[model samples]
Structure formats: C-alpha cells, structure tokens
Target chain A: MSHDKPAWYERARKGPFVGNSFDARARQAIEKRIAGKGDPRRRKSAAVATWLVGAAAVLLAVFIVVRLQDAVPSAPSGNHPVVGAGTEGSGKNEGISAAVVRAEGTAETGKLQVVPLNGEKQETLGAASCMGKETDMQFQGSYRVVYTRGKESGVVIDELPEMTFIQPSADIVQMTKLAFADADVFLLVPQYADCHGLNFYAYAVDKNGGEAFPLSFRMADGTESNASYYPPGELPAVRDGQLVLPSGEGPGGETANGPQDRIFDLNLSEKALVQSPAAMAGDVTGDSGKKALTRSFVFSGQTYTIPYPGDYAEYFVHAAEANLFQIKAGTKKKLTSFQEDEKGIHYVKDGRTFTAVPSIF
Target chain B: MEHEFLKHMTTMDDASLRDIMAQYGSDIWNYAYFLTKNRELADDVTQDVFIKAYYRIETFRGQSSLKTWLLTITRNTAFRYRRSTFFRKVNLFASITSIQSGRSAETEYMEDRYVDDIWDVIMKLPDQYREVLVLDIRYELSTEEMAKLLNIATGTVKSRLHRAREKVEQNLKEVRS
Candidate 1:
C-alpha cells in the first residue's frame, strides 16, 4: 500500500465527518425551521425578528447618510474644531478610556463627521467645500479622522502644521482605512496603478502631522523607480514602529516568475525607508487574491489580528498558541477570543469568560 | 441524466428529499467545511443548504448540474454565515467534528492531524484562492466549469487557479522550512 500521497490530498481524503448524529440533529433543526414557516405562531416570532433587524439596518443607514450630508458643507465659517489630540475646542472632551463607537462617513464637497470616539453620538466636526470633491472618511487612532477631499492633490493632514502635504499631482483612486503602527503616520499609496499603469509613491508625515518627511525604498533588484511605485495590496501601515508594506516583483507589483513577494519594513525615525529582513515582515499580502493579510496590531507589545473597526484591540490579552507564535512574536494569544455584549467587548479565553473590557465612557 | 433528478425535485416528497440528502449530504457538508473552515458552522450551513434547496427546488432550471447548483448554494450559505452577526459573536468549537461511524483510533488520529494541518494552511489563503482550491481539489471541477460557476473569464480562472496553487505550494514550503 502506497501511503506517500501529498499531505493536502490525504487531508481531503479524510474529509469532514458528517456522522449520523450531526445529520440527524441538522435534519430535525431544518425540519422544525421549515415547519415553522407554515405555522402562524412560529412565523410571528420569525417575522418580528426579521423586521427588527431590517428596521435597525434601515435606521442606521438613514442616520449615517443624513449625518454625512450634514457634515459635507462648511459649518457656517470660522475656526471649526479640528478634532485631534492637544486641541481643546467645542467637541466633547473625552479620554481614550471612552467607548469606541464605529463612527465612519463618506466625504465629497459636502460634510465630514467627526464620529465621537468618546460617545455613542455622531459629532459633525466641521464642513468644507473640498472643492465639491468627495472622499471616504476613516477614523485613525481614537480621535483623528483621515479623509480625502476633491481637486486637492497632496496627501493632506487636516490637523497639522501644513494641512496639505505630499501634494502629488495625480488623484488618489483608492485608499484604505488608516492603520496605526504608532500615533502619527504618513498617508501614501502602498500599491496603486494610475490610468497610465503601475504607479508608486512614498509619503510620510511626523506624529501629529507636525512635519512632512520624504519616504523612499529600493526594489528587490536594488533600483528605485520615481515614475511610480507599486505598493501591491493594501497601503503600508506603521506596526510596532515599523512601516510595513507589501513588495513584489515586476513593474506592476505583480509576482512574476522571478523573486517571490515579501513585506518591507521601513523605519521612519531613521528618516529612510529600509527593507527589513524577509523573516521579520513575512508576506503581509498573501496571494494575488490578497488573503491572509489580516489587520495586525501591537497592543502592550503583543501583536493581535483583529477584524475591521480595530478598536477591539484594547480588550485582548496575550495567550499562547503554536501557530500564533510561529509567524510573529507578541501575537495576542489565539485562545483569547472576544464577544461583544450589551455591557461592552468581552474577552473569552479557553472557552471561559476571562475578562470583560466594558465600553466605559 | 442528473437533470431527471433535478426535474423531479419540485415534486419530490419527503422520502425523495431524504434520499437526495442521503446521496449528496456529505458532499454538501464537505464543500461547506472547505469554504468556511469551521466544521460546526459547516454542519449548520449544510442543513440550511438542504432546507433552502428543498424550498427553492421549483426554481431549478437544471442549467448546471444538480451538484454544481447545490454547491453554489453551499458557497453562498457559508459566506452568508461568515458575514452574519452571529458568526461575528460566536467562536464555536474549533476542532473538527467526527463521524459517528466507527474508525480505528489510530486512523482517526492520523487523519485528524493531516486534515488539521492542511486546513490550517488552506484557511490562511485568501478567499478566492481558497474557493478555487476547494472547488477544484475537492469537487474536481474543470477550469471551464469553474469559469462558468464563478461567472469570470476562463483566462482569469486559469490564472487565479495557478496563483492559488503557487500560494499553497509556497505556504507549504514556508511551513516545512
């Protein structure tokens, strides 16, 4: 008997075990559910639940759109509160301990809402003409909001010494939500293609958008292309004080027959972006389909991958797992999962309710 | 030939439905597991797939094979499960569910280890890569069939499948090294 089939093939041979027990249980549940569709009593409860969810979705959508429309225009003039750290203005004064409500908005020449990082309320920070241009708004850190405005070319820092920085001539077609390696970070195209084809640029700004710094790097062949930069999948972010972005070969950042794709870590503090060892950054953007690159964040020196609205990082505590440790150090242990309840984000470890980090405002 | 089975599906009685489930239930469950990488959720999703198929049987045009149509449902159901708030909140059991049928302890252990390792690698792959692998490797669908199923160009499917395989090989190499 030959047993040396590939591991993957063997695994597929084993397949998922749909034993009689699971099948019977599933059959009963499905039968009941299907039967409930005909029974008026069961239908009532199902209809109520469906209606509630649908209503909530509609209300939330309407609320967000209304708020975005309100925030689009300039707020009746004068120094509108640019909500950020060290700014004491009319906005709600709160601390990082406040509940991180998912406050996001889309922008054009219209309004931009400063979603209350501190409260459940959506605060219209101010409005701008944005030259009748629109862009998506993403919350950075606990307070700052990163937005794109129309006709304006530079990578602008709203709450900064020079609001408009890295004023590249071309328009930004797509930008991802801000990922924080530390506090203040630069906005740049990690990988992008203009109508003219593969384009690349390195942009950087100091913490708090205080100063703009030049960012640069050499390709795998040790050559620099100024015509454009191809950042690959998602834009690079500062993780653990390291500016990490995906790097691949060929002109368009596509992985050709030659060298494999890797992640480059640039140190902004050194004022030069240098490629880190392949082992340190690994392949941040997995295959061309761009899976595997979960948003990884370092909290208390431990790196944890979290889904969108990464504010959940505050609740996770380190736990040990072999897979978690192999890829990177300080991975907020895998066993420590989370579930959000009415109280706030609750952390579960080893199938037990280990600790709860309430949304304390 | 399979169209006969699908054609009669609209009028299929509970006995016929059970027969259909008996024939295809395992296939559906396996496909769902490969897509979701969660055996328990796959179990629930499999049931939902069957239930949905039973209800929507009349809508079957038989343009695709019954298996392919069922699998499309399985993929959609699994993805919907992933997007649901329930999925977001629940971290159900991570271990693979075992069949009630008897298997020697040694056999089960070896199979579990292999499956777990392979799945660990597969799950790390992005959704598109994972989808093609599951569809091609598990279901043995051809490139043309996959192109039709995914509603993408045959060229795109071929390239994506190539890239997906390369990624899987690359990942395996990384682990071994």
Candidate 2:
C-alpha cells in the first residue's frame, strides 16, 4: 500500500479548513432549532442561507464525528427518540431478546491454531507486554491467544480503529497476545478460508443420507449451490429473518447487514460468536461462571493465549472503519497495532498476518 | 461532550445531510479544487454537495460509507459546474473584473513556491486515470471505496489506479531527468 504518492489518506490530516468550526456551530445550531420547529421542512431554506460558511469550513477542517443516528430507535438511546422505524417496538425490550434465541449447547470448544498471512511471521516486545498484564493467566483449556497490545483505551471491531480479526486454525498456526488487560470483551468475525468470497449457511442429511435443502447466496446466476458455508438447520434457509440493507430500514424490519456484523448473535446462545465487545470494568461476572479467569501463554518472543471459556473462541485483531487495528473483548477493548488508514494516522505490523494464541475449549 | 452534534443548531435538520457535511465536506472541497484549481469553484462544489445531500438524505441506505456518498454527490456537482452556463459567466466575470487580482494571487503564491507538481501530473493523466488518482490521493479512500463512490467497479478502480500511478511515476522521472 506504499508508493510515491501521499497514499490518498494524507488528504484528511492536511491543513484544516478555514471555516470548519463555524459551520459545525451553524449546523448544530440549526439542527437544534429545527428539532421541533414544525415540519422541519423549512429548515432546508435556512440551511441554504448558512451553507457557504459551512462549506468553506469543511474544506479545511478535520474535526469530525461519527455517531450513529437514532433511526428506528429500539430504546431511548444516548439522546434522540427512535427515528425511521420501531414506533410500536419502542417501549418494549428488543434487540437480543427479539433475535432468534438458540439453546445452550456445551459443545467442547475445539483447539485454536494461527497461521501467518505470508512470509516469515516475526514477533516483538509490545505483544509480550500485552500478555504479561492479562489476569487469571492459565496455560490451558477454553482460552484464546489474541494478537493485541498494552492498555490505551482500544477500539471495537466495527467501531473506530477497525482491527483485523481472523479465526486461527491448523493451517494458520501462530501465536501472540492481542493486548494486556483485565479480560473485557469478545468481537465476532466471519470465518474465511481465503479472500475468494465469504458467507455462512447450514444444511441437513435426510434418510437417504443425502444433502437436503440448503440456504445459499442469492447470486445472479440461475442455478444455486452451497459454495462455502452451512448453518445449523433443516428448514428454509431464510424466511422470518429480515434483510436489513445499508439503507438502515430492514426488510420488514427484521435482519441486519454489516461487514462487521457478529456471527455469534445469529444463533449461538447467550454466548453468540458475534459479541458486542463487552467489558469487566465495574461489571458483574454473574455467580454461575467458573473463576473469572483468562488463560495465558507465549510464542516467538511474545507472550500469548488467555483461557476464558471452555470454548474454542478467541478475539482476533483487525481495523473496521478507520482501518486501524486493535483487540476487542465483549464490549471492552485494548489497542493493538495499526497501519495507515485514510484518516489521520495508522500503523502497520507485518501486513495482514494472522498469528496464534493458545486456546482452551 | 467531546463532540456534540452540530445539525441541531442549523435549519439543516436532515441527519444524514448534516452527517454528509460533517463527514466529507473537506473531501468534496479538495476534489473540487483538484478539478478547478480555484478556491471559489471548490466552495461552489461544497455548497452543492450539502444541498444535494440534504435533499436526497432519504435515499441513502447504509450500504456505503458516508465519505463515499458525499464524494459521489460532490463529483456530480463539480461535473455539473463544468457543463453549466454559470461557469462560463463566472469565468468571464472573473476574467473581466479580477484579471489583476488573479495575477496578484498567482504572483504571491509563486513566491511561496508551492508547485502543485503532483496535481499537474494528475492533470496530464487521461481522464479515466486522473479521476481515480485524484480521489484516491486526495480522499485517501481505499480502492473499493473509490469504486463505490464513483459508482464504478473495483476492477476499474484498480486498473485506473495502476495506469495513473504509472503516469505519475513517469512524470516524476521525467522531471528528475
């Protein structure tokens, strides 16, 4: 990704625009005033009046915000009321409760292996520092070895500072701790065998011991076939689930679509593979769990592995929107390495390699 | 209150529209400047982007990043300026009244010696390559993002970027020689 050019990203950190602050001010001012000013229809005209100033400012500004709007608000969030949809569903408890709830299966979490993306995978000290600080460090069982860094308020999977998260396997065998921290959250990612294409599906075997119906991608080609994945089921691949496109409004307000969506939430029980990056900071760990412990180990001059659950699940590192990489657990996080994203600054560590950490499942 | 929402203060109540300005006004302005090399023209393009962003906010599905969406609108607006009679009128106006002022700005800028050599190389590139070069370099968007922003294919983005980079590299070598 390097070249003679400034990498198309330096444009953002360039000189700030002359009129940015004022435009932001004007924007906030107008949006606030229009909050209940009748139809909010007339706001457009007033917006036109203040357009020039904001326009001038943005050309030189870097102060930015990326808060998601309350479109179809589930509950009264951060501030604004539910927007686009969720009018009737507003008062009721929604989200996780509404999505399909799966039974708790104590499947023996399998072993984990990490493979280098390419070339000779090297290790460094920061990764070592990350593991040294992990709590309840054990050497075995249902734990994960992640590639992270020391504490410095990290970013989540889809949130800012997107870090790469790759599932470790026998082919991808390697090791490193994501970062050192009191265990906090887990981030879910779609498992990919290669860069070809990715999707998750499931099928069944009938009395004839043959592959029955399957849920595959709705590709343009007339014929359909299972290309990569299989989910857990024997019913129509899709039905009640809503296809929530990028437009925010879900088809029938049911499903969700995002590149960084959690695979765990789809059908896994309370332990959905796709977690929202949780935290143990000031939070309760419930009375029914094993000693609040995380397994730990080392590799290639770097300490790696944290045994959390008796499952073969571990947080991987990656950058989402900002194109910056870091480690995330549940809802909590630890900053790891980063490379230059389009934004201000990013770091590079071995160009997309998937390293290993010990797994206890 | 590290970053309070700004749309509240303005008549621009469209959340997506304000998000557009907040997210990518800088990018649009830079793109406009890359095209016209004129601050005023860039300003015009920026204004058009938000206005359009405001009107079409509803059409925005979360499919693309906000930055990509804004750039698409800005590109269209800048192209519109090139086609409109308003451009001719404004250019003629500046030519008639600000000829002396234009010369003055040029002299002052030259004294600073900020040669836009890169943009010049970009300007010399074929339009297909030039567009990708400017968007990729100026906006820093990924190849995939640039394709989505321009409503083109990723392969197109890669192809144009390759040709554009070669052109720039050739230009740089020539300059060095």
CA deviation > 4 Å runs, candidate 1: A1-11, A16-22, A37-171, A174-361, B86-116
Error at A304, model 2, angstroms = 57
Error of 1 at A303 (Å): 65
Top candidate (lDDT): 1
Model 2: per-residue Cα lDDT over A1-361, one tens digit each? 2355544334323432333322453344335444544324444543553454445444422121111111112232223221122223323221111111010011112111111111111111121121222111111111111111222111111110111222221122122111112111211222322221222322121212211222222211111222222211211122123211111111222223212211111211121222112232123443322233333333223433433332221222113322223343333443454222323223323353323343335
Ten contiguous residues with the weakest lDDT in model 2 chain A:
A98-107
Minimal lDDT window, size 10, model 1 chain B: B92-101
- Which residues of candidate 2, in runs, are more than 4 Å off? A1-361, B1-11, B14-23, B85-116
- Model 1 Cα lDDT, one tens digit per residue, A113-175: 232323222222233222111221222232223233343322212211101111111122233
TM-score of each: 0.40, 0.32
Kept native contacts, fraction for each prediction = 0.12, 0.02
lDDT of 1 by residue, B1-177 (tens): 544566544345677567678777778887777776665577668878888788766445565677877887786677556645332332232222322225579754653453346667776776657777677766777665665455333444555666677887788899999
lDDT of candidates 1 onward, in order = 0.45, 0.35
